[model samples]
Target: MTSTVYAPHDHHTCITAALANAKTLCESRGARLTPVRRRVLELVWQNHKPTGAYELLPQLAQDGFNSAPPTVYRALDFLLELGLIHRISSLNAFIGCAHPGQEHTTGFFICRLCGNALELSPERMQDVNTRLAEELGIVIEEQTIELSGLCPSCQLAATTAKEDIA
Candidate 1:
């Protein structure tokens, strides 16, 4: 599915729903969505950009939260554990999951030009996985689908620049 991140929209709703989902997910798992964790999640969802742990430190400190690397790492790990967020291994950054709350196959698309990220739907990823497995007869033990390319907006910008120069 196309990401609204590259488009103009009411982003506040994204953060709001993410926070609420984190709360419910924590409650169901008998876990606490502590202030630090919540804040970390907030930071991740502040935009569609993939945020590095280091990038979050100053913000956390500015907000009066513990800015220690360990503290931030722990919060990130907790969010990852609960599937509230995902680690973009290629960029070593984190972004909030679009559809969290259960186990599902997913693919992440990162815009190489802008550094923004988006979570592709599980159904799409599942279809690929099922088709490959059924056709190849191989066990799917672990996988990470990270596609890097220019996003729609960036593609438009690049094309416009070329056209203007010509």
Candidate 2:
């Protein structure tokens, strides 16, 4: 498991590990992580913040890659297909999946202030799925529970700002 996104840690290691996992997974699946796709993954892993396709356009353009909307969209879609990334529907942004090779319950806690997101994949989520499926008698295809609020740092900042005004 990776370190909590809220905690301070060596983030370069996160990017490195994610890339290695993606490569291994692609090799196993007989799929390729092409240049644009790889770069897009790298950019998404730059931080815990969710990345929008448009936000990546200029970055890719600066690196002499085609920054067309379709190119980036296709790359993002490809990564999503390989389970290398997750899309935040509310934000219309994408984040790197901590667990890349498994079919697991997924959720996200997005910071309203900073837009940083922490992925949550708790075992209990599976229980919830089970209850819903068994009780409601319906099959569960996919689901994501998203909660939004200020992160710890943002909460502290808001409190301090309030105190300063008093």
lDDT score at residue 31, model 1, on the 0-100 scale: 98
TM-score of each model, paired residue for residue: 0.95, 0.90
Q: 148 in model 1: Cα distance from truth in Å?
A: 1.3
Candidate 1, 123-158: lDDT as tens digits: 999999999999999879877999989998999999
lDDT of 2 by residue, 129-155 (tens): 899999999999978689999988899
Q: Compute the lDDT of residue 162 as modeled in candidate 2.
A: 100
Model 1: how far is 51 from its true place, Å?
0.7
TM-score (C-alpha, index-matched) for candidate 1: 0.95
Clashes (N, CA, C under 3 Å) per candidate = 0, 0
Please give the lDDT score for candidate 2. 0.90
